[model samples]
Target: MEKHILYTTEAVNQDGLNGQSFIKTGGLTVTVSNPLNNKPGTNPEQLLGLSLSTCMNATLQAIEREHGLAHTAEVRVTVTLIKEENFAFLVVARVRIPGVPLKTATKLVALAKKRCPVSKLLSGSSYYQVQVVEDY
Candidate 1:
């Protein structure tokens, strides 16, 4: 199979978790800070959760539209940073599709998990999971 490039963007983080991170395109910038601290900034865990939740929900919306259903999917991503022998993150994406049956929602989530770029990037890790839930 041939690979075709669609769109690309670059993000630069200069001071790790203590300063700022911005897009090379100059569109967005975010203050970075350690989650353990009380500083008002965004941490990696929160950023990861946002990315997964947004990507998964967007994918679910597209699938729902294709099936002639209204956009009613909600995705909640919980990211936990664990420290043992090494630092690892446990990511769980909880998805709820209101007005849709459990079976159908489950199928839609499964498909979204496969289609979402963030989900695919994390799918190989045992710490990542996507589940269909009755409530958001």
Candidate 2:
């Protein structure tokens, strides 16, 4: 049997970069914009960062659980927007697993990279960096 999963998020941007509507699959809506614009709400790039970061962390957590390791992980995702012709963006994911051995943390991050769908998706379209910033 083949399995398929589908997810969706709806967004509306109006007044140029002024106010944008964001609707999650759960029906949660909010206004989003660039903080540089001094406008209300969060920015789109940041939202992408948040999504990918959390997804990566979740994957890592699952890995820890699978290995029966008691692990608490901290993950940070950052998106950088480049201003140039055609423009571009970059994503940096930083992970910290305190109380876990460095070798183990490295292994888990490497595994998460393979398991994380978000990283795979972004890797094809943009720059993605993964770093194990801390391990005990």
Cα deviation of 55 in candidate 2 (Å)?
0.4
Identify the candidate with maximal lDDT. Answer: 1
- 37-122: candidate 1 lDDT, tens digit per residue: 89999988998899999999999999999889999999989999999899989999999899999999999989999999999999
Whole-model lDDT for model 1 versus the true structure? 0.93
Per-model TM-score versus the true fold: 0.96, 0.83
Per-model CA lDDT versus the true structure: 0.93, 0.80
What ranges in model 1 sit over 4 Å off? none
User: Residue-wise lDDT of candidate 2 within 1-136, one digit each (tens)?
Assistant: 9968685566555545556564545465566776677767877687888888889999999999998977698889888888788767778899998888888999999999888988878766547888998742
Instruction: Output the number of the TM-score-best candidate.
Output: 1
